[model samples]
Target: MKTLGIIGGLGPESTLDYYQRIIALYRERTGDRHYPEFVIVSVDLRKGLDFMDANDLGGMANYLLESIDKLARAGADFGIISANTPHIVFDEVAPRLPIPLISIVEATRAAAKAQNLKRLALFGTRYTMQASFYPKVFARDGIELLVPDLQDMDYIHDKYMNELVPGKFLADTRAGLLAIVDRMKATSDIDGVILAGTELPLILRDPIHDGIPFLDTTKIHVEAAIAHMLS
Candidate 1:
């Protein structure tokens, strides 16, 4: 099996989740105690987040490029940055790396298409929702993307990150997210919703959509990584 490399620690918790998912997936597929070989280069998330908080694209890109190079040097066969927001530097990072970076954007697009989703709502960090990285990629694949209202985006950037991602996983957080989903359901005919943030699934469970489907980007990413390794 090919070794996987992860560019991680956009936030430590989410990165750990990705690592566990990779292990669980390998165990399930191969039914062996042995796990997939992988390496992780965890970057200083405070620096990245600070750049993002200030909307400094140059700083963010530079930070990501450096991290990707470190992963390449560490002997990653293929690389993946474990966070969605940092993918804003996908163009810059992709060209610099010697190994393929399995993109969460591409993985999510494939997941949406596989489910035949025409329109989808996205919930993630402010940068992810407001910027073109995710929406542009999905649009290229002929999928329409929707974002939450400004107030909700504020909730995500301020409260979700500061409180939920770091806080102990709680029922209230799940309720709050479901409430947002309910509001989206009322306003749009979206075919589904994408949990665009890696930490989102920690708050959301079962994701009752009444009828619409929900796409978990983290799960999609894990599946993509496993396929890349085993195939």
Candidate 2:
């Protein structure tokens, strides 16, 4: 099997999830106890968020490029950015990479398409929600994606940085997020929810919430990566 490289530590927790899930899934598929050959280049989370704060996407892309180059040098056949927020600069960084870089958005888009979900409610960091990337990708398949209201976006973003990224998943926060989902389901008639942030599934563990499927982007990306590796 081909080796995988991950650009991680966009936040520590989700990156760890990607690593663990990939190993477990690869073993289950191959029916082997041996661990897969993979390398992780954990970037500084603060610096990455700093670039986003300053609106210096070029700088962020360069930072990611440097890490991916290190992955190529470390013998990664292909690579993936383990978090969703950094994918704002994915188009810029991917073309410059030495190895193929799988996209969390594209992977999720494919999964959403497979489920025949026409409308989805997206929840993530302020960066992911405000951006046009997810909408643009899903629009290609005629899927409609919606973000929460500004107030809810504020709540989600605040909790994401202050709580989730630090590995703090509070019960009240989870309830608040679910409340937003319930509201969206009622107002927008959304058929599915896209857990666009990698850390989202860490808190919202269920596959379905009130009959709406929660699209787990991390798991989708891992499955896509494993398929790519085995192919």
Candidate 3:
């Protein structure tokens, strides 16, 4: 297996999740008790996130490209962005990289398809929910993605940036998030909730949510990366 590179530090907390989980998965599969060689570039995400807020996708992609280039130079055979919101510009950045790039959104889409899930409710940054990135992939696979309404979108985005990204997992925030999920379930025939943000699992760690599967994008992305490396 080639050395894995992770474009991380989009938020420090979730990057830790990606690193630890990848090591754990590798340990389980190889039984070597040693982690495979990997590189991580923890980029400053504020500027890229600001660009996304301004709808400057090219700027966001270019900003991330600089760090990704470092990973490639470090000899990673392939890499993955450890966050979802940044994947909005994955198309623009992946083409410019020396190494292949794995996409969190794409991996989750395949997972949704494999489970034959027809509908999913998304919780992530506003850019991820309002945009067509996940929706585009899901649509092609005949899956439907539901996002929180405008008010809930604001709430989710705010909590994500101010709370979850900072590693402050408040009980009230968890309840609020679950309330939205329950609300969505009551109003729709959604099959599951895609905790689309990588840091979301910190708050919503259970594999199931209100009896529906929690489609954990972080876990899905790491599992797929491990499979690719071991294959």
- Least lDDT summed over 10 consecutive residues: which range in candidate 1? 201-210
lDDT of 2 by residue, 1-231 (tens): 799999999899999899899989999988977888899999999999899999999999999999999999999999999998889989887768899998999999999999999999999999999999899999999999999999999999999999999999999999999999999999999999999999999999999989999999999999999999999
Candidate 1 deviant stretches above 4 angstroms: none
| C-alpha TM-scores of all predictions | 0.95, 0.99, 0.97
Clashes per candidate (backbone, < 3 Å) = 0, 0, 0
TM-score winner among the candidates? 2
Give the clashing pairs for model 1. none
Better of 2 and 3 by TM-score: 2
Off by over 4 Å in 2: none
TM-score, candidate number 2: 0.99
Residue 11 in model 1: lDDT: 76
User: On residues 125-229, what C-alpha lDDT tens digit does candidate 3 reach at each position?
Assistant: 988998888898889988999998889999999999999999999999999999899888998878899999988999998898768899999999999999888
In order of TM-score, best first, we have 2, 3, 1
Between candidates 1 and 2, the one scoring higher on TM-score is 2
Model 3: residues with Cα > 4 Å off, grouped in runs? none
